[model samples]
Target: MEYARRFPGGARAADLLLCLAITAPLLLPDHDGFAPTGLPLGWMRIAAAPLLALAVLISRRRPVAAAAVPAALGLAASPELHTAVGFAVAQVTLAFLLGHRAADRPPALWLFAGVLGAGGLALLAAPDADFEDGGTLVANVLLVFVLPWLAGQGMRQRAELDRAGWQLAERLERERHLVVHQARLRERARIATDMHDSLGHDLALIAVRAGGLKVAADTSPQGREAAEELRRSAAAAARRLHEVIQVLREGDETAPLRPAGESVAVLVHNAKASGIPVTLDDLLSDGDALPPMTERAIFRVVQEALTNAAKHAEGAPITVTMSRDGRNAVVTVTNDAPAVGTTPPVPPQNANGHGLIGLDERVRQAGGTLHAHPTAKGFTVTAHLPLSAGAPATPPRAASTTREHAATTRRTARRRALHTIGLPTAGITVLLLFMALNDHGTDSSLLEKHKYNELRIGESQQVVEDRLPARQLRPEHRPARPNGADECRYYGTDPDSFTPAYQLCFTAGRLSHKDKVVLSRVG
Candidate 1:
């Protein structure tokens, strides 16, 4: 029921409600007024209605079980059942649901095969009814049970294929959009990077020229003062340029946080110079022991963490800790609480979206993990990069492996179907053969009409023995004599049933009496 909720609409609840409502009428007398077979109509319907409802209840998650419940009960009850229309109806619905709702094919396929074998077993086991032959029973079972289930399975496969096709289309569409988006972001980052590097170098050169002018021997006091102001203004413009660049390159994963050759210690020192009260704790077997990618990832993690601290927990005492644990290089950047209340800073919308996303990407590419969360005091960012796991394992070839997996699944399903069908059918066949061979009746004992007419009243025992056939009958199949006699022998006109047989009595080695031919009980 819960899984069916994924199907859509308020009708999910209505399905069960309607099922139960229909079931409510099972408590009322069957309007057809047919004689109750064994249990009353209400009680008989009760046996199966709730089960079908339960089958519907669990059809989504346990489709195979839903199919099995009615199949098993119906097969077991087939012998006593003069008509299986009720069980057949339930079975057909459940079978279709089995196929339609099944998430996988093998289970339902095997179940269908098993139900078939169970039906065969029921054939051999059910007591023979004169009105119903084995052929008709088999036909009914296949039509109302197996065929409908198979139809449902067909629909299931078609629906699954349709779903798969749509999903593939959706994924392709998403991939196309992602590729376009990433291309645009890359082009923007390249522009941003070029602007930052070229413009930043020009501003630095201008600051240097102003400083030279400010300190030159030929320069006057007013001139030096003007040069000094110019230098400060140029420096401020450079800082503003950097801030603009940070926002411009917001989601750029490839964009560098700082210039190359700067170590984590240098970054910490720079943060300290910025007056953020930063501290560094480096405890490692060797500082430069990590691989290049992992080292780069570690740098980005610390860079992102420090940036967050500055933005969100400004003025907090920040601690940058580096250590080696097991095969992982652990780097943690945690900031103490801000001077404000324990409440963490609400990050600017733009800032919250990108920096940490880049950090996560960087860490994962290096075959590691990144975690950033707030603590009671403030916020923390931690990264664990493997020291010697090498690069992440190469992804398997999905196209080729998919085909191989499909082939393997098909093979397995075929094997299971054979086992499911073969075992029970074989058992039933052997038992049936055993029953046929063990039967003890023959035509030799049968009394034909001509033989019965050949008999004479008070015929000599020798003549009667010569005319008599050698059929044997069970005591229960023999007819009751009107008058008691010393010995009576029953003979069948046909070797199968007991009716239409002859009974002969003999006394003193002579035929004393001959009973008239009569219909008798079957053997």
Candidate 2:
């Protein structure tokens, strides 16, 4: 907005008026009245005001040039007056602006100092009727020159601080943008990995069939059948690849939906079509409603798991399971583990490292967990995704309610006896052990003792209890210490929760004088 752009205009205008006010007295005719001793103090008044006004007006636009003109005028008019006080102020302001504009202009400062010294000598040679003593002259010099120089120095320091703050804010914004960009790139790499794993085998099988068809273009019925199947499978694989590329290319939240009838079942069919053995459990009914994120997450996990299995398992049978209860969906994939000491196929040179890691991140971001490990009999990947909404409402539980009421009556006496004696003792033990072990050990200043003290405490305190309290033991007195020498260890914590537990550790030691540390964090 125009209003925002000109927000500082009023302040700048006020400064211009202040600059003019300082020189307003100079405009009065014959204001520089001479004393009875024939000494003119009024001449000093005449030159000081106008020079300051000129310097102030152009200070921002052309600071050095603005300051220089007034300084030159004052120096030329120096003999008539003992001091061009305005010129001294202008010179100091010029020096400050010059240093800030191009910080290495040292010679400019020295040159100004030499000129000041020469001017002071010339003033001392003049026949002056005032300021007789060295103390008086020095006091005058300090008031006229030193104060403005100091003011200019303070302004320059403030400007530098402002610039530093702006740079820091800009750097943080750039870092945030870079992190989002990297996440997007990692997503693309994951899609590529999945495509390579799933489609590569089908394409390779098609290539084999194509070779056979080319060799037996004559009357061979078996060869013709193989060639036709190869063409159909290749078309299907190409269609799936095109779908994935479309998703990657646009990256829009509202891009086109997947083609009708494309699903994990179709993917399994494709794998089987390529002559790989695969078994699938269709646990969810066709009528089940699913969130897009959950569906995409499920698809990626299965794709990656199956691809990895086919690549390394040497044609081992793959088992895929999908189950959806009212409020949760689970996917489990398992395949025979490779024989002992069998090396995995080295991923091609263009393979990105985001395959499994991306799948894990996607599942976690959707409030689920993905687990992958080598079982005794096979390799397995299992994911449990929570439903976005709670479970569907149950029908009116008239019969269930009557049965529950009868069960509750039968168990009331036993439940009462158990809680009356068992719960409090278990709660007390849990409280005591938690207070003793968790409080001091989790404190930032005392965290370094964790390896020894915490481990010992956990071993000593582990015990059986019938019931336990639901409340968490609070570490009330532990202070947060980030930059203290007494802090013994850093406790990595949940980034979302700012509270981090630390262990006892010393402050980071300083480097020796022989070592160098760059001031910039870039290093």
How many pairs of residues collide in each model? Answer: 2, 13
Clashes of 2: 13
Candidate 1: regions farther than 4 A off? 1-3, 6-43, 58-62, 72-84, 103-132, 158-181, 187-219, 228-523
lDDT computed for candidate 2: 0.54
Q: Tens digit of lDDT per residue, candidate 1, span 252-273?
A: 3445555756878888899899
On TM-score, the candidate that comes out on top is 2
Q: How do the predictions measure up, each by TM-score?
A: 0.35, 0.36
- Give the Cα lDDT of each candidate: 0.68, 0.54
Put down candidate 2 lDDT per residue, 1-523, tens digits, no spaces: 1222345667466556556655653443331111112234366556556656666666556555554554455445552223323344444544454444433345445545544664566556756724443343354344444455456666667667855865675676666556645654666544454444446556767767776685775938887777777777786777677676655643432222233346888888898899778999978646467765667678778878888887878567899999986677999999996667777787654234445665676676556678889998889999887767333222221223333544575479558868886899889989976863443233222212223332321121212011111221133444344354443222323212224432322333421111111111100
